[model samples]
Target chain A: MCGALLVRNPKGGLDRPIALYSTALILLLLANIFPFLTLEIGGRQEITTLFGASQAMYNAGMGELAVVVFLTSILAPALMMTSSLYVLLAVRFRKSLPGVRVLLSWIGHLEPWVMLDVFMLGVLVAFVKLGNMATMYTGNSLYAFMGLIVVFAAASSSFDTHLLWHKLGIPGRKT
Target chain B: MRARDVGLASCHTCGLLLHLPASGHTHCPRCGTPMHMRKPNSLNNTWALLIAAIIAYLPANLYPVMTVISFGKSQSDTIMSGVIYLFAHGDWPLGLIVFIASVLVPLLKMLALLYLLITVQKKSHRRRLQRTRLYRVVELVGRWSMVDIFVVALLAALVNVGAVATIEPGAGAIAFSAVVILTMFAAMNFDPRLIWDYQGEDNG
Candidate 1:
């Protein structure tokens, strides 16, 4: 027999993930729009946005690195957040949208590729490394990016895939 | 007997037992996901991805991962040099963390996956449970190597102080990130159920 494990969502169910995901979406927007970090030294000032870093990498002739940074830090997170919102909202409205199953599967596959939390930690480490070299100021995006990490983690943990499958009318084989 | 031996396979997306169809075009009645006894062409796909990752791993370690320019003097550091710099600077904990996440984790994961691929191909029945656990560990820790890429991105973005001090991503970061992503895909393509497939033959 092919044994399959099924899990039930704890108390509060999908409500927590919905809230966290909504907040994460907002934070992600802010993270993209604003400057990510700023540095000043020897009377020269430089500002870099999230997208700017990727562009800078591309300009520096590291096209592949730019794509990696862009995809993991930007594209993957956006896809995860939006697809999750689409599924969670559809389930909330008691509507099984077309491709809900496909979307859900994409969310599962994209979870690890989304690295906002790791990127946030990277920002911190960069700050520590650059502390003595020059005057460094975190831009608004840094704070937003940090918030996105926490919110994304919370949203993902509380997201009950089993509950979603059930709502989609998938019969669960009880172990 | 293994599940496949009995012509039954479980839906990976949903917990539904599905009978393997003769033509193998079955779909899970419950989840709507296409059902298969094992990931189709798992070994071939994984081997291709693993080879690509191995090729990337060389430049990932050889070239400078990041460049530091301070006071008109620029210095590029490879991944190993960065780790050594951290340790030499008395930041042992962070050094260790970087070392494990960037260097050790990817290396170990590739080796583990290589072992699994070889054993499954050989139909080795030894340590089936342990091999399954090894796959799980490899899948779990594969993403941690992004730590190095993130560090590069963050520093490059934050430390753009012109001639005073600036950080630029080097070719190594690209290759390194490719290794991490490719290995992850390789792990995902590898089906753990294959580990148990050899058990019935051993018993017989």
Candidate 2:
């Protein structure tokens, strides 16, 4: 893990976890942009974006859960992926900063609450239950969400706290 | 066991893990009980949680997790069967996702808990490093087991039906709840401090 730090070589610094996080964050952003579903009921149609679901829930009087869903699914991932990207890129320039420990702890605490995979399950269950009662169209967004999950997991697994310190030439005795 | 050799005085009446002062042991840390090298109920409590988790895991897998009905036709799928259905229907990738998150992850947690409990009980000290890795895995993955439960709860609250298609949780819901609780208890009961303590003993 220490050797995998973003130290300069013949090529520029490219640590595995940093690379994983960048890819995951970009994928998550794309997943957010794409439409998860196109609901067609009684000749009316609306493509449900990830944001749209939260909005709909808020409109339906489940405001608290809506905020939770948004934070856990959207805001938390945004913070995680962005912070991860920041740390990884910073390491390449040997610019390690204080509070990396605190950020990693936050990531650890919030990781499970961000339930993209579970959200996918909710989508499928909605499809199966609404098959005849309502007509639903699957779209590219579903595919994007699937890809997003892999990128997210890879991003999380590749992250190593020790690597950040190592990049700054902080002695490798584990903090 | 020697107070002179280990450098901490013992209270012969009760065995408690206590913080000794610079000179010698002060008092019984817990219940004002005299102190010893080992904690009394830690091992037993961990084993109880582990056993409960293993038992709960069986029903969590075998019983129907969710029941879905469409147009007066109903079908039920347990966690394993759900994954199998996903695979049979050519949703193999999604099948893998459910298989791992809902099924394998929880079981891995149970095993991890068991391993931690046993190793702590036997005082195994070979892999302090690997034990830390396992502990993290168990702690992190513990709540993803709630993924299935969250789906169930959310859908149950969202979709209500009298004659149209409906969704209902099954007996496995209780068992799955137990899996979540038992694993959480297992994580909490297995002391991480024990890992460092045993490793120090091995080196000493």
lDDT of 2 by residue, A1-175 (tens): 2122232332223577677777777777777787767765555565667666555445545454456557656787888887767766766665656655445445544565577766777666556545555577776766877887887876666565444433433234342
> Across the candidates, what are chain A's individual TM-scores?
0.89, 0.79
Model 2 native-contact share: 0.03
At residue A125, give the lDDT of candidate 2: 50
Question: Where does model 2 exceed 4 Å of error?
Answer: A1-23, A39-47, A51-72, A89-98, A108-135, A153-160, A168-175, B1-108, B111-115, B122-204
Task: Report how far off residue B186 is in candidate 1 (Å).
Answer: 0.7
Task: Count residue pairs with overlapping backbones in model 1.
Answer: 0
Give the candidate number with the greatest DockQ.
1
lDDT of 2 by residue, B118-200 (tens): 78768887676788678877876776665565455434433334345455666676577677767776676665546555444
lDDT of 2: 0.63
Error of 1 at B179 (Å): 0.8
Q: Best lDDT goes to which candidate? A: 1
Candidate 2 backbone collisions, by pair: B28-B33
